[model samples]
Target: MSEETRDEPQEQSLFEAPPMAEQERMVEAILFATAEPVTIRELTGRMPHGSEPREALEHLRRRYEGRGVQVTRIGEAWAIRTAPDLGFLMRQEVVETRKLSRAAIETLAIIAYHQPVTRAEIEEIRGVGVSRGTIDQLIEMDWIRFGRRRMTPGRPVTFVVTETFLDHFALETARDLPGLSELRAAGLLDSRPPPGEGEEDAEGEEATDEGQEDLFEE
Candidate 1:
């Protein structure tokens, strides 16, 4: 009877995988509930002490590889997002070329024109909130960079257009920006001012700009 029970145990161990299914479920739940990219520190916090979700995530990622969505890591963060090829299905439109939103375009223009300008200035011009992703998108596109500090009260970090931005836009320098007249000719800007009291202030000769000139020479 003892020998028979031993044989039965070995047979069950060979064929059964009960614990892995549970691990997979937990990992899937973590990724689903997390809107921001999640990291190992975060997952371990919610998991039983010393449990290996990293190994399990690798397994799940392999299963998802070459499929609709993918599991990817950005810096220290991990996220499951739509695969590039299938992103079109999630949208309502037919997905013509993506154009920047009015706020984004306005932000880009300010950064291009006034650059090394502060976020406060960008916000002041657009009259709206700005998200990190907005900055990230511009960074990912290599169109902007963190620029020299303003010698203001807060010593805020400012943004400046990258060489890539100038290259892409075919401008010799920041000074070449279409001017009110040229932007109108290119149909890139209408007569309406960008916004705010500072909008008028930005197009003027300021001491801050004098410092930025040597910094962004391209």
Candidate 2:
């Protein structure tokens, strides 16, 4: 009877998942196969029962430190991306179709830095009226999206940067945005005041400029 009892498979052991190292490999494989950043919930759903995806991700992230391709977090999701220093090697010339005008760039920057901001607030900060085309172009790029409406009168809609923006810039969160000096160094920001501040009509003209330089590139 004792022998039979011993021979009976333990319930816990039967349901036990693979070791952490193997789980790490599984997580690595999924992240490698997927192009979009994957959330922990998604990883857990795909992994076997009793698997711990969050723990596996921690192990995988630490293991990948200093590697050619490291695991990166974009907002709440994770992805394997080429190291920052090696990015230039991956760039290839492509036909320049459309680029962000100065108005669009400024508008995007405003939204990114002061997220969940209303159009009125954006105009207040920029000292110029934001053209509808500028907002449309940004939305079409999948960079910014409409956020919750304000509690104030008229319930103005707000704008905030998207996960795509975080993924494109390799940022974990909006707080990871560079400082003023860094923006200046990268030429993303200009010291001079925008060409047509306080003039509602001038921004409309700039919004139509397709030849302008693109600050955000895919």
Candidate 3:
């Protein structure tokens, strides 16, 4: 072999990924195109083999700081969303005029407050049977999803609030949710005594069964 060949450096491939700034742009594009929050692993799967998506994401997130739109992390996923302070600008565009039925509202509250909860547990809390339509509606809305099944006799499937639910409420996690007193003040919870409370009172009023209906009405 020639001495010149031995001294020569390896040629860089033309197809090599661009610089980190460019990679940040790629990450931004992918995040913008995706409807749901994406994980670092997912980003890596879609990006070039040698690309550093995590670093790119960090750069992108910093670049978006104080902008009208910001990059946010929900659990293990990342998403581009409106800046919290400027969210009012888009409120008119995203307002949901339709109201959820009382049953659906109550069910959602129960699931949010006690996640990984089973149907029986929710029924036990609300003092009424949870209808199929209610659970189906929450699932259809993508606010709540099926979680792992319990280890008990029936091995019943559990329910949990989705990231969408947290985002809708502008919460980073379930722990950010308001306390029970705050919920009552916001009219999200009823003032009535909780289920199983009157069972021990000999003179307590009988518990009434509130009929469960469709998740939404009108």
Q: Who wins the TM-score comparison?
A: 2
Q: Largest lDDT belongs to which candidate? A: 2
TM-score of 2: 0.76
What tens-digit string does per-residue lDDT give for candidate 3 at 13-98?
A: 56887799888988999999997889999999998767899999999999999999988887678999988787657756843444
Q: Give the TM-score of candidate 3.
A: 0.71
- Per-residue lDDT tens digits for candidate 1, residues 106-148, read 5677788777789998777655556566677777877789999
Q: Against the true structure, candidate 1 has what lDDT?
A: 0.62
**Collision pairs in model 3:** none
Range of the 10 consecutive residues with the lowest summed lDDT in candidate 3: 209-218
Q: Residue 122, candidate 2: how far off, in angstroms?
A: 0.5
Angstrom error at residue 60, model 1: 1.4
Name the lDDT of candidate 2: 0.78
Q: What lDDT tens digits, residue by residue, belong to model 2 across residues 1-218?
A: 79899899857744788899999999999999999999999998999888999999999999989989999999999999999787656655333334445677778878887899999998897677887987998999998999999999999999999989888767899877644444444344455445666323345433322212232221
lDDT, each prediction: 0.62, 0.78, 0.74
The order by descending lDDT is 2, 3, 1
Q: In candidate 2, residue 110 scores what lDDT?
A: 81
